[model samples]
Target: MNAPHTPASVGATQRRRWWLAGAALLALAIDVASKSAAAAWLPGRPVELLGGLHLRLTRNPGAAFSIGTDFTPVFTIVAVAVIAGIVWYARNVTHRGWAAALGLIAGGAAGNLVDRLFRAPSVGHGHVVDFLYLDWWPTFNLADSFLICGVAVAVLLSMRNVPITAAPSTEGDAVHLADITGGRDGR
Candidate 1:
């Protein structure tokens, strides 16, 4: 029912895992650093940027658009679950695009989870630090950006019918379009 993995395929899968880990770490680091900078620099004054964009710090205890203000702990729990699910799902992600997508989502959720766990108002009730603002949109941070971008990429990949795991090649080591698209029509 399953073909045995060659050394080269194993190596490629390992590389994909490394890419996932690297992306997660990088996203987390950037989010943490940016949040710190925003907290330090945006307390007393808000910076006005181009095209109605501004840097204004706000601590949100709820989810997007400050929804469910009374359910801070619930959000924290959900984030933890989401991160765990992503990690579990990543084990079979041999495709680099899916790996990156999952990594970004996990890292972003972890970044916000850190805030929810230790920022303020006590553990599991802490507020997330949001600094970026726009006149038409609610305030957000880098972690949210990563999450949105990751989801967008994932959606695009799905629309293109890209598989999360590499498809086995029927002819030697060469992957054919039919193998990926499941048929010659690319459907």
Candidate 2:
């Protein structure tokens, strides 16, 4: 049996949705701005930074280190699906951490999707703008950073057994692991 949502609970869920949207917009804005700056300023003039980091601009027609270069349109489609999934899942989020995590993921995906839809080469097949670089790693952008960090947060929350919605057993108190995983054995 499912418990009916109270007015307070509904309000909380709405707040979580706002958090998700805010985080996504913030991440998307930063990514788009940074990419534009990189495209405008970092061509043929790499700048070295601390810790072996460099500001170098490159356009990638593929996903992650130029892999699957032939599947740019597929990537765009996947990104759109992922963003939609995040928005759908966020509707029931009652946890602030989960809201932020989903928001960042959606924002990052949208950031790259913008590039795929509008940047360089052709529409729906444009290259992603990558600028930040390290000698040992493929060049990445702010969107990638947001995606990585968001996933990391989500993993941590899952490992801790954080509940997405309020559990009836907790009665507005802190959620416990058993309330989420059933027991230590996860059964």
Candidate 3:
């Protein structure tokens, strides 16, 4: 029989998860720095990276590519909650990549949240800085890119179940998905 584990080991693992939190902070720093530079140096000026496909130094204050700018209050409330939840869950994430993804997303969420809190000429209402504009699409920023990519990666990772070393007490053997498979189990 496996020995009962102590709570401290679980605490250690929780602390280890902060490694990903650091990574997310780095991403957030970059996003914030870039956005600040854009707002200060190139507010209206557009830096075209590609042939009308990519741009820089544009502000977006809205959901993914300026989708919900008009509804700033609603977005801000939702964003704050999501960021809080991500930070909390990040403490228990086992997979390194998933932790990293969560960090990136948390950073992105924070980058925008900070702007909403401080960058504004008003209170609790600041526009998020965006710079990557597409002539054919809406303008965006690094934080938005990180958020979308991170969420997509997170969703994909969540679809796959990670294997656990501990087996069910009854089976006394590690379980593979095959053990659960049936004619209709493929679904």
Give residue 72's lDDT in candidate 2 (0 to 100): 93
TM-score of 3: 0.75
Give candidate 3 regions above 4 Å deviation.
1-12, 163-187
Off by over 4 Å in 1: 168-187
Cα lDDT tens digits, model 1, 23-85, are 888999999999999999899789999999999999999886567878999999999999989
State the C-alpha lDDT per candidate: 0.83, 0.85, 0.68
- Give the range of the ten consecutive residues with the poorest summed lDDT in model 2: 166-175
State which candidate has the highest TM-score.
2
Model 3, C-alpha of 139: deviation from truth (Å):
0.5
TM per candidate comes to 0.86, 0.87, 0.75
For each candidate, C-alpha RMSD in Å? 4.1, 4.2, 6.7
Clashing pairs in 1: none
Ranking of all candidate structures by their TM-score, best first: 2, 1, 3
Q: lDDT score of model 2? A: 0.85
